[model samples]
Target: MSEVRSEEEKAAEARRGPRRGPGPGGHAMGSGEKASDFRGTIKRLVGLLRPERALVTIAIVLGTISVVLGAVGPKVLGWATDWIFAGIIGKQLPAGVSKDQLVASLRAQGDNQKADLLSGIGHLVPGQGINFTEVGRICLLVLALYAVASLLSWLMSYLLTGSINRVIYGLRRDVEHKLGRLPLSYFDRQPRGELLSRVTNDIDNVAQSLQQTLSQLLTAALTVVAMLIMMVTVSPLLSLIAVLTIPVSIAITAVIGKRSQALFKEQWKSTGELNAIVEETFTGHELVKVFGRRAETEAEFARKNDQLVEAGFGAQFISGLIMPMMGLVGNLNYVLVCVVGGLRVTGGSMSLGDVQAFIQYSRQFTQPISQVASMANLLQSGAASAERVFEVLDAGEQVPDPATPGRLGGRTEGRVAFEDVSFSYSPDKPLIEGLDLVVEPGHTVAIVGPTGAGKTTLVNLLMRFYEIDAGRITLDGVDIRDLTRHELRDQVGMVLQDTWLFNGTIRDNIAYGRPGASEEDIRQAATSAYVDRFVHSLPDGYDTVVDGDGGSLSAGEKQLLTIARAFLSEPSLLILDEATSSVDTRTELLIQKAMTDLRTDRTSFVIAHRLSTIRDADTIVVMEDGRIVEQGSHDQLVDAGGAYARLYRAQFAGAAVDIEAQDGMASVS
Candidate 1:
């Protein structure tokens, strides 16, 4: 019994954590954890895009065409510049003088440099002014190229948006499905707020990051490549200068990105922890106030908020360095290109028009690099969120149902039998061992025990909420595991100590037990469970609205509603775990009467700490240390003077003293 209590205490402590807080010593949960595999997480994120691969491929093609056309525009515009310059110089020279004759005269006049400079302008018509027709044609051609590029770029963005949204939609759906498949134990270990962060906040961040970065990064990459090729075609020297900045830019990105990746991971982890704290605080706000721990709770929230702030600041600040550093490198490359191209043009080896185009190519090349660098922080943040989401998706699921499930045959008799069952929450601490019990159809078995005597665990095992480590539990001669979970659970109805009601009308909440149940049947169950008494006082009667917390309803009233819900189910087997714990004396009496009527011809298992409630049970089983120590009618156990007798004596003795005090006070008055 000591071991059982100790194990139960440990489990409770795990759920509550230290000081009833989010983590050890009230720290954030998993705050120190880091992503184990950054590259692997990125690969998995890319895999999510695989379903829209065809759309993505088309988008990529369009982006490439857009970038290529944009890149070619500068080189084509260079032709117009050359033509304008040629006409300007030609208008200054003597008309009727051929370009060769002028160059020869200049060389003969001992001006070889001038002659060579004039020799390179092949399109120059000596003595003619600028040609408006040719320049206008070139301008129109450049305009057309830019217009087409813009249209293609817009189409590419549209395609990417569609693909990204579809992928995110599927991701959210998978997360929802994954949650359904997870074992109860997983939820026991995880904080509700932290899990919500992963499902909502983290997934939203992933979607936003993908949406903001995917198309931009693709366009930036192709722009860099196309621009480089155009630069090389115009002037190899300038292209080399631009290319040299690549290594430096990569170095900057690598160094800053490595540090920011860790920070981003910390930022998201802290975000989840902070969310957990807020959720826990809000969910238990009344309890926190009742205990007067508002200051302490606020202090904890502040501490977590501080951690998140520090992490977010560090992540953004470090990533922000990439843009300016790349810009500096780009400017230096630009200066080098300008100086070298100027010297080459003066020496008649390169034309001014080509130099002008090369400069534009150089600028275009660096712009994409800068753009990619600027998005590093978003990419890292998204990757961190994706890793967190993948953790949930990759979590081990509960044991699956049988492929070919066994049937209970027609009309289940609710003959539940535990055959040499053994189970434990932990391997080293056995809670129940070789436990055998059988309840026939139409029998009401009441279970009584101390707080940690495996009473509820037994019911949980029977429901297959937690599978037994050994042996089989059967219903109607068929092993429960052989039946599908849904099939097995459908035959059972349970009313727990804690009541749950969703935000809906009273009638809707009751009808939740048996969907599509007729309105008349719902009211009949509510009347039988005694919920109709108070519900009739309300203006809306069964149409009155209530939330999951049973807003404005008294505890006893909420408990009655849950009871009414169970009555509507009409299960073959019923399990009531402290069903009357929350009610007053009058309500309790009414519920006992209703339960007696409801138990007719149906097997019922009642777990209770209240000895008075189960005195008339068909069989009272007293449990100690996970084993049945006494089994008989209440009078039979009392006569035997066993564990049950002592419990009965202690309880009634306390009650008798309270009554005597009241009588004495009445006499004195």
Candidate 2:
């Protein structure tokens, strides 16, 4: 176990995620972004669009059709108005009998054919009079067209919501998969709050904005183009007047977009920071209460809350200005068009029908621009959220898995070796250096150290949670770097000092690492770990939910569940960190017996304070200040009179009653 490798090579094989932009200690951690960041965000959004191609196609087609329906209604109404004026007031009815004769003729036709006759006249027969009766009929027809348009628009909203959510669901699934495959060190730099923000809040923002905001923007843009062409066709002078309003409105939108985008980015960051504070404080609630730091916690939370408020206000302040500004400009453009078109009407340069159609077209022009302006806040919010999501996607992945992962089909031998292994969580801070060790198959080795003494770090390296700075680790004489992470971890079992049981049943937690375990296997494993008896005593037995850190169970019971988990895996190599430390005298003795049964025929690395547990270990490596200070068997170390001897004697001098209890670490559990 002494093959040395350089820092670069170690980092390449390490399970820790790649470090990007420099962070504290010159290690890269994502912090925040600059204003120019949104450009990259837009590019990323374009990529996300490819997956939703079908939805996009449907939205585009339906949106255009929906807008056409809207424009057609007003134009139809204007045409019917012309027919009414000629038939009722102008006496210009198309050389037919008086208005009364036309009404009587229409009345003689059944209501069914009133529609048919109206349709016939709508075909523009030259000699036919469009009497008041026909004009009134057409007005009802215009309303019917608009009713259908409104229904289609509502349908489009639902389709847009579905399209966006489907994309979001796909993204969330990918992220969950990535999290399980990502290295442990990836979690080290990332506070749980920040990662949660990415998985939950940021992703939700992407979906929500796509549903209500982005789709509307797309609709508005398409509508504006369609309506502008309609306006120019109706009358170029009026179209020109309406088009002038677009540039200034867009410029205002741009300015507000920048300010709100920045504010929104800050808001997301602040949200992560605030979440981190909550998680940290709540997790360490015991320590905080003991120290009476409630006021301090409150002050910190208030500060974060205040910052969040300021950011929200700033973003809202800018984006909120767009709609009123759009309205004022649109209103001004409408008045101007009316004045110019009215002059043309009086001069007989344009027909009254043309002037009326121009007015309708002008409103259509402003409608899209105004609608787009209204969605500005949500657009900026989406951009801010997009940048956050991309940050994770762009952090670079853990070392790529092999094309065909090499699997050891059978139970792997437990032989282990470490070769000149050195490591550092960050470049400037080294945790272990040139560590070398060899444990033959089925040997139990105990590692001892003070706080931060790197004993846990040793187990971390063996598990490939973080890559060693130099050298390599191996199992059965094969370098672990060449092994698939999943394959390597499958043969190894770890029971952390702090056992984590997900929101699941006790039986489920026990069988988590070995899902195919039968109920008998679970019970036998728990029995050997001394947990079966306790479980049998509970009202629900193994079926009970272990929620809130298994608060329902005692510390000893929780540790036993973890031990059962490790046993169920039947791991070739086991790392138990202070396994029996958190138990009463009786519980510790029971655990000791359970541990003895599990240790035979398995290579185990243990970190425990009770020297008695290691008395039978094949080897004992004692650490002080991050270095191994002693190495030998338990008896040999007791005789050496070094750090191990001092610690041993100190514990040995305690009453045998207290030594047997060995329950000091229970509260920590």
Candidate 3:
């Protein structure tokens, strides 16, 4: 009943996907733990950028230069206006006055009305083709600068935008590479779909924010600073009036930006949850339909979707208000500047040009602040993404390989011994308890056990997939765990009950264990596992594409392919965990023969439920619960009347059948 309950609970949890919420217990970052600290993540990502970095760098440089030109152009225009107002309008110069300077200054004015006004204010009659022609030249220069800057800015936009997509590919590749190398236990705590969302959706968000908003923010800030400085130099009072709206704008922006940032974070978190739900439901679609729980699934998904909508709206709503508010506040400041600065100009304290320049400066000042308010949502999204990135980068490393560890070569004879082995998945519950075992070189040892009897767990130990809590497993008298897992696994081969095949050709799958194996070697291994016939029967023979988990083949056929793969690996130690369970009775006979051929020169662990398969095992260990209740040869155990004896009797039923079973033990029927 407890087993049934556990299964039911697992099924239910699997349906819900990774359980998550915006609870207080999340990896919330301090301001100091900025995303910039993700050096490992950055290094890995940069490694993938090797294909496009040169072009990408050129694009970024061009874009940055264009931004500077555009920003500096406005300041130059401000300076031209300031010169006309300050020097020309005041009539008598501050010092070092000359008519050439006076006429040249008018030419540099650029704007006709402004030049004429400054000329009129100057009380000088420096007219004719010479002065007006020079002014035309100055106007032409301003126009040329504007055109060039704007054109490059537009071109840079296209180049950088394309580069952003290229960059995303690099980032995705690096993220995948890192995930592949991470230990399996990492997945035990974090859900697969959630991690996928980080790699895909969250990373995309970060890319978008950096490409779109961050670059613009940098240029906008410089433009604002340039404009403010020009305004202040021209007329401090006028500049003061224009900048009065700044503090108000900043206050409004801060409140909105902060809220938007927080909401966008929630949005990303919710998006991950939404994706997790979709992944969970899709994988369990058959069960969901069979259980008649479609409505419940829809309802659950709806709840998550609504939360996403709320988060998105909250973020966008605050961000959307930025442009309109900035424009409104800026226009209001424009009105104030015109009124006050106009009064000052009429009273001979300033000029019409000064008023015009001050208005331009006001716009320049507010534009960045306004844009940043608009960018608040993007910043928040990026911050959220960076938070996740930092989380992965800052995550603890797995148990590392020891320095100068033993290396296992192909010559390993595969004598394996577990000396007083004990293990636990968690500290509170031990899985294997003092699991002492010895499989002699070139011998087949069968481990028979019920469910939760640590059958597969023992396989995990043999492969060094998990670290043991106590004692040691040795390969050729050297501790397996002391050796790097990669080295240890090099000499061991495992064929799991569930056969997994990649989306590749049959030949590719067969050769994956040994990439350099010749076609003849591949063919021989295929023949040994009895997979050669099946391959020949396929439409494309070895070249047939096995799409999606080898779904084209039967479960038993996939198992045979795995067996063939194991045969190709040709490891010194072999583990057959119910390897033939998926094969038919006829196929099983061939596989049994293949197993005999492979097990001749290597130590093998045979874990099976079929009693007939283990009859010839040099040592048959009958396990109940977690302990080995009894062990011996088939005849010896039957004569001893232990757990193995009772189990044997139950299988063969009578004395005659038992004796017959014992007779065929040397070569399994």
Candidate 4:
């Protein structure tokens, strides 16, 4: 069980650092755009509570009892007041006229007028007009009702807590499940912080509102209806006076609520904007310092921060106006009820007790109106959050898996082919068209070209990360589309330029690709990838913990761990995408040796950043503008004097110049 913390303790913990979770905190809205379908969002939000109908129904029944008991308490008190008045007046009572008999007589006469006046407290007294003991009993009954209602209120809250928690849990689980089904392309355009926010912040907002506002909303509604009924039961004349101000209260609320709704939308949007800015800046703090952009970044942050403040102020200030204005309307209605009741009392048609109860009932009626007025902001905020969460839930998912997927059992020979494949990130601008490439088994194909040469696009198609616009890709003489993604990807291994690592021990990270791999298997793979060299130096060896994205390790070490992970997976087809681009010269040499050994018996496609690294590849395909310009061995490409030769010569010339500059410096020293 989680120990509940005090507000101060929670605040202290918050001050320490960011909260740990599956996703980053702070920014939550995937887009700053306000939800256009307010009603739809609310409908979906309510639908989440369908599973808790039994609990909700019980809460409603109990809530109704509680509101009714509290509403009628004032009227019961009025009965006691009439008893005290009758006693002081020294009025003679009819013989044997018990409280029940008088109430029956009053109702038989069709005069609920004095029935409300004398129902519960009218009992014959020996010398007194009204019985004091009976008066005491009625008062005690009202008090008991109040006490029972309070207990019911507590029970209702307990029930709602469980129901609301389940609903929130379901919502979060849906989001987690949705994320797994979404395609990688969806994440490419989205900010990581914003997606994290949707899961963490937006859902939290919805949960908080449901927890805090749900019971109040139900109670306020019940109070309004029940109190109105009680008020009319007492005296319809004064009830009319109380009811008249309701329209005025509503008009005022509508005006203020409209402004608040609009402002609240902008407020949340501004909050999302601010969160995005903070996330981007903090995540790129090192880059900002390297570029000497601190002042400019601060200025940008201040501008967004200022917008958030202004929006927050507008939203809160407008919403805050609701309570004061509604209070004024309620007070005016109170005065009207009192004035009318006082006139009726003086006219002998109403008793002092009746007047008092009417006044209390009037306050009760308008109090809910005021509460609802105040709840406007919370409702609007919750609706906005629900919209954001629903946006993710409703987002387009990846292409569906085949109904009956083909199997890739045993080892694959890794003969890959692209047959007239065409693709484009955008429909209008085709990047690769009718592109056909075939790699025989155990051949290393090096894709070389200038930037935006459709090299990575080819890899994306091969992996089916994104579906091609036309044609097919095959592995081992089988169309990849016919196979399940799990089956196809199981045969392939990928190492990108940017390495990714989680918060775990080195052994755990390497074993991720092969969860069932034994300790011996992991160690052998690590040794093959040269990760064992550094593992021995650490006190914990493979048990050493890596921080965020393996920040504890150097970029080269992180890459090496990823390579070891791939090696452990034992993929038949390998892809090395600029795997050593960011490493030091010594680290690069080690990585090259490890990669060469790993690729010896597998068909590999190397997307090289440095031309020299792929000099020993079996084939080099030079591409530009989505079309292959030249294809041959390294020596064949150099001798051909085509696009491949030009690119090779340029890289070679740059390397020669760097060597000469280094030699000059060394000679001078």
Which candidate comes out best when scored by TM-score?
1
Which scores better on lDDT, 1 or 3?
1
lDDT tens per residue, model 2, 124-149: 33245457676778788888888877
How would you encode candidate 1's per-residue C-alpha lDDT over 299-383 as one tens digit per residue?
8889999999999999999999999999999899999999999888777888878988999999999999999999999999999
Backbone steric clashes in candidate 2, count: 5
- Steric clash pairs (candidate 4): 27-197, 28-197
TM, every model: 0.93, 0.86, 0.79, 0.87
Tens-digit lDDT string for candidate 4 (1-669): 001112222222234333321122223333646534656777888889899999999999999999989988999998898778777543545655555676678689998766665533333242466667979999999999899999888888889889999999999999999998887666655666667767888899999988888899889989999988998888988888888988998899778877776666676666665676677777677777888888887786687678778977988888899889998888888877878787677555777888888888888889888988888778877887788788889899988888987776678999999999887766766678999899999999999887777787687778777788898998888889898877888888878776777889999999987888999999999999889988998879999998766766878889889899889988899988887776776566667778888898999999885854687899998878788888989899888889987886777657746644654665576
**Any runs in candidate 1 off by more than 4 Å, and if so which?**
1-28, 652-669
Which ranking of candidates, highest TM-score first? 1, 4, 2, 3
Model 3 lowest lDDT segment of ten: 1-10
> How good is model 4 by TM-score?
0.87
Q: In model 2, where do residues sit more than 4 Å from their true spots?
A: 1-30, 88-130, 140-155, 624-626, 650-669
Q: How does candidate 2 score on lDDT?
A: 0.75
Model 2 alpha-carbon miss at residue 427, Å: 2.5
TM-score of 3: 0.79
